[model samples]
Target chain A: MSTTAIPTNTKWWNGGRSPFNASYGKVMMWYFLMSDAFTFGAFLISYATLRFSLNDWVDANHVFNAFPFFGHQDLPLAFVSLMTFILIFSSVTMVLAVHEGHKMNRKGVENYMILTILGGIAFLSCQAWEWTHLLTGEHFALTKSGAIEMLNTTVSHNPWGHRISGEVLTNALRHTSPDVLRSMILEHNHSATLASLKDLNANELISKIDLNEVYVGRSGPAAFGSYFFGITGFHGFHVFSGVVINIVMLAKTRLGHFEQRGHYEMIEKAGLYWHFVDLVWVFVFLCFYLI
Target chain B: MSDNVMTAAELHMPHDTSAGTGRIWKIFRLLSVITIIELALGFGLARHWYGEPELHHTAILFVKGTMCILSLAKAFYIVSVFMHLGDEIRNLMMTIVVPLCLFIWFITAFLWDGNSWKNLKNTNAGSKPDQTEQVVPAVIEKGAKE
Candidate 1:
């Protein structure tokens, strides 16, 4: 019998270590991502369940219809599309960085990492703009008796619309001279006059205007603000953290740390985290914006 | 050779099997195309091109389904290609994927349960369910009576 005895002390035969044939660090990153995914999943599913049970939830289309600097042109889904593209492009840069890292191309890795970091910063800026616009914009709440009430919305109560009621116009008319008001309306080519703003009821006022030009308040399910802030804010926090990590990674890359290590596994690991962040955003986009 | 030699150029050369820059760019283009399509659908379906847009139950359900599918596809591409999960060993892929599937199932179950909670709260505030009528009998009828 020429059969050799099976080796008992070999590295591969060690109990329960690297059973998945991946590096320890890589497997650990996967585990962390899995847990983080659960946290996000719980938040989104709760949002959906609550939204479904509510009789009068705000339509996402109406709430997220604004674009940057376009000044309310009814440009629905445009800014978010741009935001989504930015994140996706950042993810591409991340993948390219990892690829360059695999080739042991130090300069390529550094360049791509820098691009990825810039993309992250851009996405964060866009998100900041969206949040600022949301918090500072005009809002209105529909009252029980069919009259629209202007609301200075805060974190607790955001009815998700811009309804400048007849009272507001009336107040504007009172504040400004007739010539100035006439010039303002003429400059904007608005059909409203100071006389018309004086005696109109809320319904009559709403009827006289084009709903697209004015912000029409949706029937908000009471928990809309809570869910919107909670889920999107949590996701935004992740994006911010991811950007910080990417900056750190970029610094390490430029310092020749990965090059000295003779492997770009660190870049690969960071790329995994970045891609996971993007993945979470996909779900968030669907839950908050699309569905 | 000095034992302090830890420089990258001194390290043993390993085989580099990563795809070329061109291939990476190609994948990027594909991802961009898919995302643009999703954006078109999102904008097109929501806008009132005609008159007042009605939110029919079936229409809402269809749009929701389409959005979910597209989002999942985007996630799949990013994970499998960009994260290189698909290129990993089968055991490794299973280690990540199986747990994720279970997590998704848990979310669905919990969400359904939450909807039930909302329904119960809305219909009968502070009223306890009749255990004999709604709970025990159901358990017994499901063949746990023995």
Candidate 2:
């Protein structure tokens, strides 16, 4: 009977030096994705923690709404459903590109990669528009509930929501209301016209309104807007950078660099990054749109 | 080779990453449709069409649990076949899925604990623990306060 000696060298390449011998770029990308997944998981988990901990947080619908042209109504989280489908579609295309890469099909890989990139750009643009809407104060309502009676009414506010633009506001107020009109308008103004009250931007004509009466965008405490802006803004930055990278990759593909390489590693790498974006949006959509 | 373009068939797929992504894709498609059905069922329950919020809540709990599991199945298909994580060592797959599971589990516990604590503080919402003081025990006499 002979005893076998244990081999000392085990790594595919000592510390993964030989990229080809090792898992190549794809496997390495998976490792990065794992760690990145953890980061996103932490953020999403933290969001869940914070959201659950809060006693008086804004309901998702009250916070997010459809586009300006989409009936201007407080739409449910349906738009996010569309966004999710788009991302999943992109991910599928990316997977197809990876499959093609293995077969050494450059043009086919390029076609799918282009489609995936387009999908990514569309998702990011949607996110950007969403963030801008939240930041610039659109499609949100001010709901008030009397603590003692549980009597709730949404005093339609938002200084920006006024159909009366600056020109219109100035025109409407051109003739100060008579004693009765002034009092009625003043009461309605104090009660209803909310965004006007919290005048962060002095540019708007309503900045002329009394400061104490207006609180920026109806929800209690400024933490509402702060968290909304902070998280979505951060995600927007990711999308922006992702777009820049995708654009470069797209241009490189158009120049036939991937054709020479006989592999779609560039496309695959970009796909991984695009998937990360999609994953982040899932969390964002769940938190910001759903419960 | 530079001039030779990749074929559409090759791009659609050439290698079998796992059992069959085609089959897997079809399964996922079925799963997604089922999920949509579950979602509607959940909504139906929520609307009290089946009667009683408690019953509805319990139904939703199972429904949502099913949805979550089905979603994981989708991920498994993608990772195992598409990403070939399944082809990796069994231990490696566990390395990914297990940790993710533990994370979700612990977070669920934390959320429940936090909710209970909030309800405790409020003296409203869900039921609270005993507020009455405990009576001093007549010593067991075994140790005499030792």
TM-scores, each model vs. reference: 0.76, 0.61
Q: Report the lDDT tens digits of candidate 2 across residue range B1-146.
A: 43333343222222343322474366346535643554454344333432342335455456545655655555555555545555454434565567667666767877777666544544434343332111011111111110
User: How big is the RMSD of model 2?
Assistant: 13.7
**lDDT of candidate 2 over A1-291, digit per residue (tens):** 001222446453343233122134555676677877677666666655654543434544445546646855656455555566776677777777776666666676778778877877777777776655655542212223311111121222222111122332333333322322223234427553444334333233333544343222222323445555666667767667766777787678778787775555666567666666655664565455543
Highest lDDT, which number? 1
Query: Model 1's DockQ?
Result: 0.25
Per-residue lDDT of B22-135 in model 1, one digit per residue for the tens?
756776787788777777767766664212233345555666678788778888888888888877656678888888888667767876776676456445542665422332
Superposing all C-alpha atoms, what RMSD in Å does each candidate have to the true structure?
A: 9.7, 13.7
CA lDDT of A76 in candidate 2? 48
Each candidate: chain B TM-score:
0.62, 0.51
Q: Give the 10-residue window scoring lowest on summed lDDT in candidate 2 chain A.
A: A146-155
Compared with the true structure, what per-residue lDDT tens digits does model 1 show for residues A176-243?
Answer: 33343333333333666667566655444434444334443522444777787788788888888888
